[model samples]
Target chain A: MSSALHTVSATDTLAGRVLHDTGVAVAECYQCGKCSAGCPLADEMDITPSQILRMLQLEMPELDDEVLRSHTIWLCLTCEMCYARCPKEIDLPKVMDSLRAESLRRKVAHPKARDIIAFHKSFLDSIRTCGRLYEILLIVAYKVRTRHLLQDLLMAPKLFVRGKLNPIPELIRGRSHMARIFQRAQRKDG
Target chain B: MTMKMGFYPGCSLKGSSREFNESLCAVMDKLGVELEEVPDWNCCGATAAHNLNHALSLSLPARILALAEGAGMQEIAVPCSACYSRLVMTRHELQENEALKAEIADIIEMDLALNAVPINVIQALDRALEGASLESLVVAPLAYKVACYYGCLMVRPPKVLRFDQPEDPMTMDRMMERVGAEPIDWAFKVECCGAGFSVSRTDLVAKLCKPIVTDAVKRGAEALIVACPMCQSNLDMRRCAIKGMSEAEAHIPVLYITQAIGLALGIDRKDLGLQRHLVKVALPRRAVVGA
Candidate 1:
């Protein structure tokens, strides 16, 4: 029970890691709730944007874990609404990005985030192979990963009829260069 | 003599929102601007890269900027607002941190002079017009009520983008007015349209787009004018998903800013890709004399 009362230093917390990764000090947020007030998806999020910051501010291991596992990080559209309206100018989206990365690394991303993660992975994989986004390939891969094959099936033919969905992707000549960039970026991330 | 400008039509332009590219090209061609495509550009990584790996996001856009710089282009026009935001954010990040810029340069294997700046569609068109009013070039003015939806990426993080008023941006509205269209003041102008989740989280996208579409219609806007591909697609492509919207409300067409301008310039409907939209785009036509 005494362990629950033990104070965790700011530098030894998830907020510290966020600060180190993004240079956005979560401690600067004074819980004005302005971020939550402006967040477009606040109603849908399991944890509001400002609450995520408050969790970080708390600097407890349990709270830190909660922040990492919360669906708010995945739900963020990176629209910068919170950052724009935040009186502290905390750049909450940047912090969310860091939290998302950490969440994936720790394998504790909310289970509901599966589809979103699948879409992102598929999107990146398309770029990795073709240098540009191959929408057809991305959709196929996403459907395969999410097992939502029937989903959006009706819209595909419509897009194709509109000349929006091309059968063959336009490949850039600098394929090898793009591969090299991806490899180096992965290495840097590791 | 037509002015040559560097053009980076990001992935969405080539795929999901080809109409945006078509209309943009048609309008620019009429405006005496020749779009020079950047040689062998790759994806800017968009939301995925930044969400997963920060270095990759910076490296991808840095590579495009480097290619534009190598081509001796002073600035490149990015029509997609998402790509524009990524490129501009990369520039701002690199400018702020020399070490990160060097790291990104090493990753992309380029000198990264960062000379080639990115201009969004509005900025590009504004520059192409060269201080002349759009009314001067209009052959068929788009005389209809419109809600200019700036969406999220184009105007947010105001300190970095520095292009318009973050909350109540009127640049697009002013442009629409110049083209003889009535731009209405409405909420949800700079709101998010649940971008990047169109494929994965359709429910969320529908819920987010509902307010934007409803507000525009409630304000009696004939069409929702947008500069971003994601915004247009979310509002137009996902209109059917927005539950409880009346049949008439669901039919409100979302038009790309370039499409509206192309119509005012008297560019052919097919050339502007007007037939490509899910919702039929039939603006109330009023007679106007070409200047």
Candidate 2:
């Protein structure tokens, strides 16, 4: 199949609807391959960072390739070295970011994606309500999401006994602001 | 005039490494900088999701960036190297990847200010150290030979990062000396130590860690001062396995900059998250005053 540039739409929340409205210029990428050379996890990437930037410059998606599969999408660490190193400054991590979100919205997300999403969701949920990340909630949700409850369970007793964890969360005063922000931000996207 | 910082310690300093937080506060206080912790902060995902799924990881940090923008702070100081990397990297992506930004806005149901700047501890420290002549910034010299460990998250794949050389970064080392500390020049500073995978996959760490520790010790670092919590925890906790495969005992202490700051500030040992450490730590005799 040939790569075709799709027109960005109002529903186009990810590709070109930058909040600032000016959008990032992908043409800035110079194909330095430094993004490729510096990627620690490039071995697992479908196309290297340099290739990904080049594909973006050409307005083509690097979604195909069996071994390079969606698995490569997960392999990008969002380290920003590629962007910092790209002579053209192609925003390689954002491309990965777009592809990764697309993967989940399309429901082809790796099984592990849900677990990661859940951990983050619960992390933010704890913050949205409490106005700060509830450490206990964060760890519990992470362990629960990853299905590795026992991994950090052993540390809870020590943390609890040592007064490291506030069993009761520290609820902030301007708590309503947090919820309101979440509500409005969520609605804006909707 | 006091300079206010939007301090984002990520998950580690709040949960596991309290001392690092305490030390950082004390040290920064001496520098006349006050870190106002963001009222509401979320996990930056660190090196985990970036390795697992790109979009999920970017949005995870982007959402927090969105929240920070909602909080009204434009420049935020990130203490964790991993969190800093994720936040800055996500900022770069959201700015340059419009299509990706649109997709994320759709998925997260929010508009993240891609312009929200993420500054690392090195940058933050540099900011805090601003105005004061580097000569006058030295409170107590961390004269001990310290291995400045940046790990893979700090510098790699350069498109989004621009502070220093990936293979050999000197920003942290140069900063260390400004604070009266000796920074050991060592290879493997940017090597990966299996980070979060240290649990799901132990062998990966053993192989990665062996070289990292060996290189640090071989270079005569009295200890390693790390900007990344994952690196500090991994390098410290996995010492047994690393040493099991080695011919000599590995007693090097891995200290978070926060912990080192606590020590330099004459804070109590109990305040530095020292007891939480698996490996035994030997604080300098001068720092023993607080305990």
Best by TM-score: 1
Q: In model 2, what lDDT does residue B64 have?
A: 74
What lDDT tens digits, residue by residue, belong to model 2 across residues B153-173? 677555356778876888878
Mark the regions of model 2 whose C-alpha exceeds 4 Å error after superposition: A1-37, A42-69, A81-89, A110-131, A152-166, A170-190, B1-6, B39-76, B86-118, B130-140, B152-162, B192-210, B237-249, B283-291
**For each of the candidates, what fraction of the native contacts does it recover?**
0.84, 0.21
lDDT of 1: 0.90
User: For model 1, how does the per-residue alpha-carbon lDDT over A19-122 read when each residue is reduced to its tens digit?
Assistant: 77778877777899988998989999999998898888877999999998999899999999989888878899999898998898889999999999999999
lDDT of 2 by residue, A1-190 (tens): 1113334333334334321233444445556577778766677545676664444444323322221235556555454556655665555665665555455546575553455455555566676667555777876777676777777556567656655566777676756755554555444332
TM-score of each: 0.96, 0.70
Model 1's number of clashes is 0
B1-291: candidate 1 lDDT, tens digit per residue: 899999999999998899999999999998889999889999999999998988898899999999999999998999999999999999999999999999999998889889899999999999899967788888888878899999999998998999899999999999999888899989989999999999889999999999888899899899999999999998988888889988668888999999999998889999999899999997767776543
What are the lDDT figures for the candidates, one per model?
A: 0.90, 0.64
